[model samples]
Target: MIAIGGSAGSLPVLAELLEQLPASIDCTMMIIVHRLKNVPSDLDRLLSLKAPIIEPEDKQPVLSHRIYLAPQNYHLLIEDEGTFALDYAEPLHYSRPSIDVSFASVAEVYGPRALAILLSGASKDGAAGMQRIIAAGGTGFVQDPASALFDTMPLAALELCPEAQAMSLTDMVHFLTELKMSAEHDQ
Candidate 1:
């Protein structure tokens, strides 16, 4: 499983990363992006140019080769059985679809099978979540702060977990592809 975290200045980076990724890379991708209330965009339509995208139905099973985006006004979490759990609970860090919540959930459920990616964003919403991924023996990757359009989120992740692999957006895609390949070979 791969959990992606981002907020402000994430659209371009996300699009680019998705475009570069091979369609064959098999893994469940969960994206936690911050958005305003009553202004929800069709994520499936927006990202369809890149890969297979879906807005997970409530409690839908997580599947490989698909991308899941958090719905409006909800925090999307992963369950132990590879399914989604959407909560309308109060926002964390002033964001409803918090990256930290999704990452932490993946850490608890998938543990070492989880791969957390922190992308460009304005705040430090994902820092603690990245730490949880590490503590759970999962791999954590943060976009290189110098390369990010907004450095705060990635920088915070680096500060919180210095051992994380920080890379450019292009490199991050390559790394994910490699990780997927490795997992497939192991299986």
Candidate 2:
């Protein structure tokens, strides 16, 4: 399982990452991005990859090679039973679908099997979550601040967990390519 979180200035980065992912990549990816309250989102239309991307319904079973997006105004979580659950709780860090909340759930459920990516943003929302994921033995990746359009979120993650890999966009793509190769070999 992989959890990816971002806020301001993250859309383009996410788009590029999605576009570059290997066709045979085998994993379930959950995306948590901050959106304006009550605004309509076209995320499914904006991002494209070989995997099916959808706004997961509550109780939907997590499936491999799928991309689940956190809908606006809801906190997306992974249940212990490997299903999805949406929460209407108050926003954290001034945003619903809080990266921290989603990442925590992923860490608790997938543990060492989880891989988390924290991207460009103006807030520190994803820092604690990255810390939690690392504590739970999951891998954490923070986009390199130098390459991020907005560096706060990535810097925050690195501050909390210096062990987390700080990667440039090129490095990130290369890492994913290697990950795809690894997955193919395993299959």
Candidate 3:
């Protein structure tokens, strides 16, 4: 499993990452992006050009090669057996669809099988989440602050977990693609 977290300046970075990644890449991808209150979002439409996309329903099973977006006004959690659990909980760090909530959940659920990516954002929302990913024995990737449109989030993540890999969007895509290929071969 892969959990990617971002906010504020995420759109272009996410789009570039998606565009560079192959659609057939294995592993389930769960994305948590901050959105406005009760706003109806169609993340699938925004991302479908790059890969199969889904707006996760409660208890929806997460599948490989498909990207799942946390729905608006809810926290998305990863469950055992690669399923999702959505909740209407109050916001964390002043944001609903919190990256920390999602990353921590995936960390608990998949442990070393997971990879967490922290991208461009204005605040520190995902710092603790990326730490959880590392603590759970999962690989953690943070976009290099130098390359990010907004650097605070990535910088915070780097501060929280010094071991987290820092890469440009292109390098991150290459790393994930290589990881997918290596996992396939191992399987």
Candidate 4:
């Protein structure tokens, strides 16, 4: 499971990442962005233009080579059985569809198989979740603070999990592609 969480300056970065991903790459890709409260949003359409992005249904299978984005005002989670769960619980860090909530669920479900990516954001929403992933023996990728438009989120993650790889957005895409290639090779 690959869970990416970001806010503020994340849309462009996410778009670039998706645009660079190979169509044949195999893996579950999840994205959580702290967006404003707006119904009938076009995020799924915008992101799906680059990749096969979906607003996952409850109990959806953990399918590879597809993209899942958290719905506005809802927390996206992976159950222990690898099913998708969308919750309407209270917001965390004043952000619904929170990074921490989603990442923690991924940590509990996939453990070391999970990879959490904390991207550019204005606040510390994703730090605890990145720490959770690390504590579960999972890998984490943090956007380099220098490259982030708002460095607070990534910096907080690094402070919590200093061993996390911090790199530029382009390097982050390369890292993800390598992971996909490695997985295919292993299979």
**Which candidate should be chosen as best, given TM-score against the real structure?**
2
Q: What lDDT is obtained when candidate 3 is compared to the true structure?
A: 0.87
Clashes of each: 0, 0, 0, 0
Q: Tens-digit lDDT track for model 3 on 13-55?
A: 9988888887688778888888887666777688777776788
10-83 per-residue lDDT for model 1 (tens digits): 88888888888876777788888888968858765787677767878778988877888888789999877778
Give candidate 2 regions above 4 Å deviation: none
Candidate 2 on 117-143: residue-level lDDT in tens?
999999999899888899999999999
**118: Cα error in model 2, Å:** 0.6
lDDT of 4 by residue, 123-160 (tens): 99989998999899999988889988999999999998
Better of 1 and 4 by TM-score: 4
Q: What is the C-alpha RMSD of each candidate to the true structure, in Å?
A: 1.3, 1.1, 1.3, 1.2
Task: State the local distance difference test value for candidate 1.
Answer: 0.86
Off by over 4 Å in 1: none
Question: What is the alpha-carbon lDDT for the whole of candidate 2?
Answer: 0.90
* Least accurate 10 contiguous residues by lDDT in model 2: 44-53
TM-scores vs. true structure, each candidate: 0.94, 0.97, 0.95, 0.95
